[model samples]
Target: MDVPRGFSAIESSAEIVNMPLSMCCDWQGFTYTMSGWHYLCEMLREYKLKPKNNYRKSILKKYYDKYQPYSTFECFLCEEEYDPLRHSTPWVPLPWESAFRIRLSDNQHFGPNSNTFIRKEFVRTISLYHRLESQGYQPQENKDGYIRGHFLKKGDDYRFKVSGGQHRMAALGVLGQKDLHVKIQPDWKRVIDIQHIHHWEHVKNGTYSEEAARKIFNFYFETTGIEKAKKYGLL
Candidate 1:
């Protein structure tokens, strides 16, 4: 393959579905592998080294909001009922919705965005989805019901997180679908926490404001007629 000046061309066709332009040329990721492409993408996801907020924003701009929101409203990814505000039951503060997605195929970041966790069931679902995909079946997603999360510009790294679609994302990860859809809530930290999604009530430095809290409780009340929200845990 005739190569250019700076690009480290992937001569191996076994894994060379798309070629991402290298940072040596100051490009974001694969020139040919735009996110919408059916296969995995290769983008520079190394937010740790390049911690510049602009680069993080660029990733969000380039990859996020490409798809529309889901039409039908539901509580959270685990919940099935149509409850827009996710507070009906004291569901774990940080369940699947609190995870940040890491698309390993996107060569944008230098190393993997670490520390994100998922349920064991997530893996099983991925295998199922993979089998279905092999049978020529791809699932559907939308704006309202798609993965909602954030890729925050943090200390020498951008944190990839989730607001919904835990299982769907796991399937993508299992299938190596790096170039997929994302709804990045840049201010997600202010509203959610991946590390402490299950323990938010104890966090003092950043807590969901009363108005937001009330709104969620209101959702709970509307769904199940519960007036009081859960109490804040002891510090």
Candidate 2:
């Protein structure tokens, strides 16, 4: 299948839009803790480094133990383990993973078992949370700088998916900001009426079948988008 690219690379063509925090979600369309905002908020509130580390470890261990067996590979760049089974719920790999596939694959240092890797990731998340909280959200002067995302529309309803600046979004969420200004590409209002946006997370988390996911993907994305999904054995 040749899935046509839905997101644009040119940043100048993008526009900023204000959306409610309740309608915002991570790249995979998950909100709150599943979207990782809760964890980021917890780290921001905890002053003691040891407690933060413990908290991070516990969270990672819980998810890792449950999902690691299904993960085909883990990417430290985003501090996520990629399980084709879960990610390919809709028969397409997450856009960021597809874009950074080479870098992610080459940068797999010490798998999930290494404490050093865990500690480094924990520290990185904490640093990002603190930096955004203290310095405030500064939109980078690049395509990847802003809180970039896209709107998934289903009839009259819409949801914003944060494709970039996830940590910054989480920080802002903790700071009690209800309205978010998100940078979106020219093709931002892509219709995805195959299903409700809230059901997307359920699809990614393995609650939905691949058959259903394929139906959704075929409805929303073009044939060209599945090349990466095929490469990841998602087909």
Candidate 3:
């Protein structure tokens, strides 16, 4: 994946842990695989996140399909969403995790007792995560010394999508972590219900066209430019 400009794997101060929602009931699982990562600029501000194009090929799409299977995340339909994973440059591999790179992408599904199929890139990246953890590394903290995500309310269902820290979240999962700390995305539901219209609440009008629906989203957040994106965007 391609990383953003000035993107670097620096220390995150949030003492947050993001885990899979499937840990609860009514979710699916798979054979555990390591995890993956890409260097990116630190999220200096708070706002919602989205992909630029190819929603069909986005990891965020994968996340939504996995977690918020029933609910409709209309905002995600924004064609202007930026795919952070799309512009990443793989950092040099660390040690231990790199050793297991050969075990990636087990297409045979032969691995056992895991939630995901281990892949080389994930093996290497998660290995770095653990390596840093071994050195007493900690997750960047929110204002409460904990980092988390916003949950979008779709009808009666609530969906929490990972914006910036997808790699870290997956790493913690493979390492068998629990007690992930996150807060709801502030104003998310309100933003969804803009214009006092349920239909306009999200981009669920059978398609996504940011140009046509920018007001619904842009009213509460910024679009997809660097300087303006972070003002209303999330990680």
**lDDT values of the candidates?**
0.29, 0.45, 0.29
TM-score of 2: 0.53
Off by over 4 Å in 1: 1-145, 185-235
TM-score-superior candidate, 1 or 2: 2
The model with the greater lDDT, 1 or 2, is 2
Best model per lDDT: 2
**Candidate 2, lDDT over the whole model:** 0.45
As a whole number from 0 to 100, the lDDT of residue 126 in candidate 1 is 37
Q: What ranges in model 2 sit over 4 Å off?
A: 1-14, 33-56, 69-114, 140-143, 185-191, 195-211, 214-235
Q: What is the lDDT of residue 185 in candidate 1?
A: 39
Cα TM-score per model? 0.27, 0.53, 0.31
Q: Which candidate achieves the best TM-score against the true structure?
A: 2
- Tell me the tens digit of each residue's lDDT in model 1 across 138-198: 3233236444443322123222334444444433443445444344334444223233334
Clash count (model 3, backbone only)? 41
Q: Tens-digit lDDT track for model 2 on 1-235? A: 2222222212123366556666666543335332232334444445344553473455433332322322222211122334455555322343312222322221222123455555555566667767766776666554556787776554445566666766676667666666655667444443343454335544556544545443433322222213322333322
Model 1, residue 123: distance off in Å is 11
Query: Least lDDT summed over 10 consecutive residues: which range in candidate 1?
Result: 226-235
Candidate 3, residues 176-208, lDDT tens digits: the string is: 554355433343331122243335422344132
